[model samples]
Target: MDKNELDKRIADLQAERERLTGELDKARTEARDAMIAGQKPGGTAAALAERLSIVDDALAELQDRTRSAADSAERNNRKRRAESALEATSKRSKLAAAVDEALNALASSWDAYADALRKDVGQVSGAGGDLTAVERALTNNRAAEPLVKALIQSGGVKLARTFGIDTPIRERHAISLADAENRVAESLRVELLRVKAESPQPNVSREAQAELEKMETAR
Candidate 1:
């Protein structure tokens, strides 16, 4: 396909993905509201959840297609001059290896402390600010919160600070894009198990029920 056609298709797919995401979000919100209100969700919640899952699958497929199309178009548009320019740019990137090594060290440090940090931050670690800020700071090897900076500097391989209060070694230490995500998933699984145990017989729809089962099996 021509570049213009490929670009248009990518854009259209992205728009559809966004729309589906919004719908899924709305459905989740409604389901949460119902649970908070102590209302027994009839079939609507279950159906909404099923529809959301289907939309999520479609979105994933569309994103893969969009990326493939964009890549093909870029390759089709590449020329000898562009190749030479890219090669020269890569050769001059002296800081690339240093940056990669630094980030790897930070990720390792974070992994060492993942369990403690998860307990301390709770769900906030997965949300905005804390995890995002810490990860960004680590990636650039820039300064972040005093504790995080110290953690990165230590390479997550040794002690950086001591707490007067009694605490476990893991809590006192630090360690990814992938590493960070894995930690979050680890924390989430723990939280989900706790929630499932505490909130037994939750009056949710079949869709939510299925999702809960999936969460249980995530690890």
Candidate 2:
């Protein structure tokens, strides 16, 4: 059957399963109460026992159906994922090749980059224009970081903005470690809200759509 039909069937079975489970519990309680009252077999006690058996059988059947439906849904999802991955393989390979070429080109200009760094920072007496020393100086100069990044971006045109094969570098607002920690804390709150929305709750304290008005008021 189609996805919508399968989903509806699963949901109906789940609700019935829950109902059967509750009925079974009630039957057991009734049987216990009858026995405590010194009731004999083949009457109220026997009726309750029989009802419990029927409920258990129905619950088991529903459980099997639920599992089969869930497995079918999972298989459909897996097939879709496999198809998407196969489609993207060619793009991924091209991006990988571009990245390798960029690295090789950058490697050839290492000495020239070090010389430029020395010129920008001004040479020290003992450094003696040594390539390693110049490279170290460039690495240690925090001011040169932005310039180096710009150079890499310029040389790697395939990796630039709007290249859909992979994510391109972009400027982002700098935040402190404390700000990052606070963002993670907020993410936890968002996750809690998502879980509450998705979980099936027979009873709820408040309607989520109504509570959403609080967010608007805060804004």
Residue 18, candidate 1: Cα error in Å is: 3.5
C-alpha lDDT values of all predictions:
0.57, 0.53
- Per-model TM-score on C-alpha atoms: 0.25, 0.30
What are the runs in model 1 whose C-alpha is more than 4 Å off?
1-6, 43-49, 69-219
User: Which candidate number would show the highest lDDT if scored against the true structure?
Assistant: 1
Clashes of each: 8, 0
Please, what are the lDDT tens digits per residue for candidate 1 over residues 1-219? 555765666576567657766776777777788889998645555665576576567657666776887787678678666989898878767578776787798678766655455565645654422354234433334333434434544544234343222223253444423455565565565555555555546653444556667766974
Q: Where does candidate 2 stray beyond 4 Å?
A: 1-42, 90-219
| Per-residue accuracy of model 2 over 1-219 as CA lDDT, tens digit each | 555665676576566657656766676677678778997423544565565566566657656766787898899999999989988997899998998897787566655755755674433323222232223326653433333334334544343333332333333422222343344444444445545555577233244433444544765
The CA lDDT at 67 in model 2 is 76
State how far residue 66 of model 2 sits from its true place (Å): 1.2
**lDDT of candidate 2?**
0.53
